[model samples]
Target: MMENKPDEPVDHLSQLPVLRLNLHELAREQRTEQGQLALRDLTRLLSALVAGHAAVQTGQVDWRVRGYTHAQPGGDVQPMIELKVSAVLPLLCQRCLQPALQRVQDKVLFRLVEQEPGLTQEELEAEDEALCVRVAVDIQAMVEDQMLLALPLVPMHEVCPQPIVVAGLEAQPIDLPARASPFAALASLKKGK
Candidate 1:
């Protein structure tokens, strides 16, 4: 007979059956979870990938989530969640028009508040976000959103792999066709006059 324990952490991502996370329970238990999501599974993210790499089977994003409570002013307790995401994306290089591997890694802290508060000047500078309480959080969607934010506005290789050709400097002289100047006709007409 197989036995399952609620407190024990499950190391294998395959064992996790649920996609939505209960934030209230997660913060109460202060649980930490790590998993890998296949690139093929994220349809919206896959669409942003290069055409050739759209069907890549080995590409995946490694994500780790930790939930806990933070103490606020005036003896108030706040629920918080920290998410770390990392992934290597195969993107098209805008410079050489080829594939360039890019690694995207980010850590975001979200505070699950009963009501969202207006951002202060200091809060704007911090990476933390005030999130309203929800029934369930779609972990995959959060991971996808983070990955999308990490994508470069313009993907490029450090050094372009294509051959370079400098202007005003040629290895070979280009062939040219000889032609008479426009003033030649004027000279002929002047002579006729």
Candidate 2:
């Protein structure tokens, strides 16, 4: 692999050969890896990360990946991939309906498996931290997925960008005649009778 010059920008992570690296071998090699990619490169992946009022495609996200092969007490080898991501995204506050900055940082682990194991409902529900994927994994896609998972379900400011005022509450009361009692009509009828 040609090393990038310090002055030149790093190549997109998607173009890296690391995607095809055998997990076990990579873990053993302890590869020296470094790359920077724009958040906009993950257009489709970040499509749902923004609120209706904020545009988030223009931002920077840092990514680092490491592989590890762990030997269990029983001598079983566990091939795992670790990914770290840090990003600051612009999001709209749900309460104030204004643009706000959102910070997202996370580390995720992927356990490499030849094929997906069929787990019972209980097991599936119990498993949350480590995900298993096939050997020939798409690293870029995985990175995008991890970033999406880290996004806040609802992004909002601790103190709203602006005060929220209810339109109905703020509006002036309408002038109208007082409502007449139902008994008034009955008394009128009795008088006529």
Q: Which candidate ranks first by lDDT, i.e. highest?
A: 1
Off by over 4 Å in 2: 1-22, 49-58, 121-136, 171-193
**Model 1: per-residue Cα lDDT over 1-193, one tens digit each:** 9666998765554554658888877988999988998886666777767766643467899999899998889998888899899988888888777787888798889988787688788868867888787688888988999888878889988897786566689898888998899899899999998
Off by over 4 Å in 1: 1-18, 119-122, 164-193
What global local distance difference test value does model 2 have?
0.68
lDDT of 2 by residue, 1-193 (tens): 9888999986565474544445555556655343555676676645655544233545777778787776779998877667788778776678887777888888866666666667778646642345555355565666677788888888889998567888768467778899999999999999998
Residue 179, model 1, lDDT = 85
Q: How much does candidate 2 score in TM-score? A: 0.65
- For residue 106, give model 2's deviation from the true position in Å: 1.7
RMSD of each: 10.7, 8.6
lDDT of 1: 0.82
| Per-residue lDDT value at 117 in model 1 | 81
